[model samples]
Target: MKDRAVLYTFESVHQAIKGEDVLRAAGIACEMIPVPREISLSCGQGLRLAAADAEKSEAAWRQAAVSWQKKVHACRVDGRYRYGVEN
Candidate 1:
């Protein structure tokens, strides 16, 4: 198995859902994950993808003209969470 990465975050669930549809339409592999507690304890969701595919996913979202407030972050799923730049 391989580690995964988070692609983007939206201010509301509706935006996240719409973004998910756009990413899927663009042929990007993505799923909705609970927003990390570090960011918010609320039930907000975000899009996840394979770390290797993060860049492509971001580009696809941009090309689709989706509006998102936060940038993507690279995350490793080990016991320890590591954060990196969007790329």
Candidate 2:
């Protein structure tokens, strides 16, 4: 949804997949999407998450099956996803 605030950028697609698995198992609502060009063209995928669950998501990611680059608190400003490092 447009209100969702953060996108967790993984180091790699594999890591993003692992993150998806972990969040699913932990009951966090999220998905693996192509890493938006706005975030980073270098990465292939990212995990979109609800802004409200950010704190819990952080814990979930810590227990993820793999690692991520770090999460970004993304806000769609002027129709673009503007972001900042969340760690």
Task: List TM-scores for all candidates, in order.
Answer: 0.68, 0.74
lDDT of each: 0.70, 0.76
Error of 1 at 82 (Å): 6.1
Put down candidate 1 lDDT per residue, 39-73, tens digits, no spaces.
66667887767777767766776787666766556
Residue 6 of candidate 2: its Cα lDDT? 79
Which stretches of model 2 miss by more than 4 angstroms?
76-87
Top model number, lDDT: 2
Q: List the residue pairs that clash in candidate 2.
A: none
Per-residue lDDT of model 2, residues 57-79, tens digit only: 77877765466785678766567
What RMSD, rounded to one decimal, does every model reach? 3.2, 3.3
TM-score for model 1?
0.68
Please report the TM-score between candidate 2 and the true structure: 0.74
